[model samples]
Target: MKTNNNGKKSFVQRSLDWIEKVGNKLPHPVVIFIILSIITILVSEWVYRAGVSVEFFDAKANETTTINAISLFNSEGLYYIFQSAVSNFTGFAPMGTVLVTMLGVGVAEWSGLIGSALTKLILKVPNSLLTMVIVFAGIISNIASDAGYVVVVPLGAIMFAGARRHPIAGLAAAFAGVSGGFSANLMFGPTDALLSGITNVALNSSGNPYEVSINGNWYFLIVSTFVLTIVGTLITEKVVEPHLGAYHGDFNEHEASELSLKEEKGLKNAGIALLLSLVVAFLLMNPWFGPFQTIDPETGQKTLQPFMNSGLLFMVFLLFAVPGYVFGKTTGKIKDSNDFVESMIEAMRSMAGFIVMAFFASQLIAYFSHSNLGIILASKGADFLQNQNISGIPLILAFIIFSAFINLFIGSASAKWAILAPIFVPMFIAINLSPEMTQMAYRVADSSTNIISPLMNYFAMILVFMQRYDKKSGIGTLISTMLPYSIAFLIFWSVLLIIWYALNIPLGPGAPVQVSMIQPLIGLM
Candidate 1:
């Protein structure tokens, strides 16, 4: 009996250690993706009913195109799987957008402008205000792609350590801001543009006439930025820091303060240069006779209703290009123009891995769409869900829960939106609820789960990082660390949205919280 009891205690201790250490340390994102992929494939079939057709068009012509009656996976036999996979991976993937955006974004990062500017600016704030600023910076860093992961996270850890707080707490706080605040930002970005384009596609397919502008979700996102900052700071100070105890780890103070006076000066000059560049770009883009202007002269009618939409990609290019060159020149990082080109080249090279992953992911999505599986499932699922008779606050609450759960498996906000938009957007539109509300709800769900989902590519990287700090942290450690923010954000953000919806606030320019369903407004091509 004594021996058994001893053994039982030993086993229990091991189990607890595993849960606290090894299990939590295990890479989460890849594991989650594999599991979700399996489930998605298992629960869904490629085939739908015969004679069903979805109309679309080929890119080559103005003529109409149609997605025919049956699943290619079934009708075309075994070989179709490979073909479908190739099509999915190669065509209509979000990878290109990521690549194109990164090309411009990477230049800013590689040139040291992003890091230098953030460090100098953030460090100048009083220590009391610095933490919040750092968190806010992390949230805004999403616009620069990898800058948050590469610069902010480590910089944050170091910043907290300098102030004699637990470094891991700082790291966690920064990571939370960067990933947790992914969906909310002050500025419109490439992701916004891409997602909006896809949203328009989904809406137009359902016979809606007007274009859904990129800034459609901007109003709510602006509010979310403040909410994320407050929540992030509160979580860091209250939950994460206390849980982390004190900083006992080995840290080099000098390493944390490596920025030289030259770099600081360079950063200031770069800022001025960036401002000048923006001025030039605005002057060029906005001029009635400038080559950059898209409007027609004869009619005096504007070609681009949302100027931001037409100039977004170019704005991205200028955002990076001028800052990068200015920083490189002032800091002697670029001795000449050749150096600037080389910096851009190196930035593109870094995305090789992302491009590869995107290839596979794209294939999966494309093939799924090509198979007509998404439409079939969407139509059936929406039909059933619409008939469920859930309404008002309860239905909205249910929508939140549903979106949150789905978010755990699918990490890409836009990709998940693309899939869910077709289903939920139409359903909400069919009812009295608006697509803007549904989209906003989806964004809330998508952002909240990012911290917890192991399927998030970065989630695994974060686990590896935690293990470096404490060999015993694992899935539970990560989840537990972030769970507070997740819960708080969900409740508070949802309440905020509910209030917004009830007040009938416009989500963006002309984007109503609710649309009249009794007499649907139709637009002609």
Candidate 2:
């Protein structure tokens, strides 16, 4: 028994060392994206010249279609590459969202509103439930998009530090919930709309005339929210915290201080500001009088609508900015408008690396899309699966595993699903499985692997957060530390999904595991 235990320990240590070594040897993420962009351009040319084509069933077109690679090395491709470069960078989804949201969050953090609020809130919680609260908060924070990564994750570390526990454990738990449990939210957010929209496109493409609602997986995800919280708490307390032992780090002395009179006043003012902001937002979104309300062309009904499908981001901005500005004024952190502007500028400065990386990433993604490589690969993969004579639960499990493996390579969940949905949604439908079931499985796989994927957009940000305490922390340290959470989430979540499938639970409103009337197509099988 002792020998076996020693062997396990030795193996773990060696694996960690190797991961660290390999990760450390890699170029900076921005450079890596630039190299990838160049490679993609070359590959597009090569594939186009070689006449690589795939026969895919175009669901939207309701017919078979041949997809050919478009080479980016030609005159037309060169013009596109040059013309679209600036637009690509400017229009990158995360670029604008993060920048705009941070303008508000920056003021809050600079004004000490976030710190004070977090301290008071966390200090009130019993030590035993601290992990649970942090984890749960992180899970729910997905409603505000990437705010959790910026706010809740670091706050978890701070709260844990204040409680005299291993701060990294708190960080891990929060990260697990924020990224690993990203799809598991109690409320539907922008991600729901974004992913479901893509799924709908794929469904339409696959000749399915029905559109999936945004809340297709809401029920399953709500339950998953609690499951992740419970699992995150257990893993943090039992495995990660213990393995981390005690913290004798630079942040040990950074305990929470009692709220001062001015801070108290600031909090009061901030609360009032938040309430007012909410009221204003509510009015703006009201169907009867709201300026943002519009008529849906297809449905021909008046409706309160999101601003460019990004009402959540705008709402977050309002929630943070109003409270932050009030807090800053009340606490004398901002004596004038200059201070507020400075705060926003400082926040933008911090995101310089992300901006640089986004430029290259945008190019890479654009090139890849033009090349038709993603769709080709997805179609081939689906064809291979179809030929295997697999169906039912086993097929679902295999797909979940395949998605997880692919996640390690492709970081963006939406981008990956955009490619995979057209292939799998119809295939699954042909086999009598509901599109919702296929989507649910994909979500499970995507969220579970987020923490360990180096290509994840926020991965570098996570490292920077870790380095605040441990200067030696790097890509390997972050991955190794997070590996346990990833494994636990993947195993437990997959089990939950399988159980859900077996019990034939409704994934959401009108979403079922299998469709009764839809018989399997024997010819396709």
Candidate 3:
């Protein structure tokens, strides 16, 4: 029997040990993706043979659409397998974002700009407040796709090491906010646009005049940003850090050192370049004569929608590349344009393994989507809830739970909502619930489990980050370290949600809990 007695392993430790041993025994991530791809191919054929199909509302087409499992085990499937190989790798969205972002980030990192910044941050921010700030920054970082995992998570470790704290704990905190707190953010992003569009399609299919705004959950998310920051900090300090004990690794001592005169000069120039770049970006986006500016057809006012939509990615690349180049030149780390190019190449070298993993993962994801199994399972879950006689808070709670369960399997928030929204949005409308609330609930579920799900696109990248700090760190270690933050965030975030529901607060501008039940009461009133 396991006990807490001296020399006897406690139950939790034993459990973690078992998990680590078992997980480490599993296949490598690339091999695992290959295996899942095979499984998806075989299952598609089986399900198709079994005649499994689903009929659901098509919000986009404004009609009922039927889905059936398409067998990837057939001759046609073999052709697709061969034909789409390169396109699947190239078209995989996350793969492109990471690869491109790394080109600039790698240069910045290799130029010693990122390291010097971490040292400055360590000196400025209080150690007591460091974890909270990192976690908060992580949540905010999601505005730039993949920035949190690819940037903040590693920076957290470096900053923590500079502060003489446990680097793993710092990594855990950043991961918690970037992923586990993904549902909570102060601003709208691609996720907001994607999910809202899906939600609106569902609402359109329901024939409801009510439309969910992209900022529908804005206020709640604003609160969540702060709430999650506190909760994440508390969990990291109280649970994750104590469990990690102390970091005893041979870390880069230069990370904590005071920057030399040249280094400080480089940082200063980099900062100015970054700020000036932002000002130029604002002018290009906001001025009436600016190329990116557009006049609203209805309001006849200039808007930056074009820039916000199309320019953000380029902006992210410049944000890193421009400052990095200036810093490199200032510090003489980059003697020529070739030195700059070499730094970028070095960054790509680090990502060599991840790029391989992305290739296999793309194939697996493409196969899964082509097979229609993900949507089928999601629909089956929605159908189960619809058949239940549940309503009000209980139904909402049940949906939350089910969506969270669905999240364990499906990693894309937009994909999950595309299936869920068509069913739940209208059904909730008939019962006095708003589409905004439905969308909000789905967001909560979508984000709560991201850290623990191996299928999360960035999970492999984060695991690589973990190994850099702790050679013994495995999938199990990353999961276990993050599991507490996930649980705590799920619990408290849900509680905050419940409290918000009970108070009948406005979810955002013109978004309410009951949606006024206007359509239902129209004739009667």
Model 2 / residue 349 / CA error / Å: 3.0
Residue range 335-433, candidate 3, lDDT tens digits: 998999999999888787777878887888788888888878888888989889989889888998899888877778877887788888878877888
Model 1 weakest lDDT span, ten residues long: 55-64
Scored against the true structure, residue 407 in model 1 reaches a CA lDDT of 66
Where is model 3 more than 4 Å wrong at Cα? 1-14, 294-310, 519-525
Residue by residue across 1-525, what tens digits does model 1's lDDT show?
012344453443343334446545554433543454444443334234345654432212223445454443354633565655666555532344444555666667677776665555545656677679778988898775545654567567756766566767777778888888887899867667667766666666556664567788889889988988998898788666766656666655412345788787887887898889878876766656645656657447654434443345556666777777777888888888777778768866765544554444444444444455544443344445646888876777777876776666555576556655655665677667777787788778777777887555566445545654565656677777777677777888888889999899998888888886633533211
lDDT pick, better of 2 and 3: 3
Better TM-score candidate (1, 3): 3
- Residue-by-residue lDDT tens digits, candidate 2, 1-525: 012344453454455556756765767656767887888888889888999888755544444568888889999889989999999778766666677788888899888898788778767888899999999999998886777887788778878887778777788889999999998999877788777877787766655666678888899999999998999899888667655556778554546678999999999999999999889887888778888788878569775544645666767877898899999999999999999999899888877766776777777777777777766666677667767888888999889888887787567787678667777887788877888889989999999999997557677667666766665666666787788788888889989988998899988998887874343332211
Ranked by lDDT, the better of candidates 1 and 3 is: 3
Residue 510 displacement in candidate 1 (angstroms)? 7.3
TM-score of each: 0.64, 0.86, 0.91
> Who wins the TM-score comparison?
3
| Winning model by lDDT | 3
Overall lDDT per candidate, in order of appearance? 0.64, 0.79, 0.82
Off by over 4 Å in 1: 1-118, 138-221, 240-261, 287-381, 408-439, 450-484, 501-517, 520-525
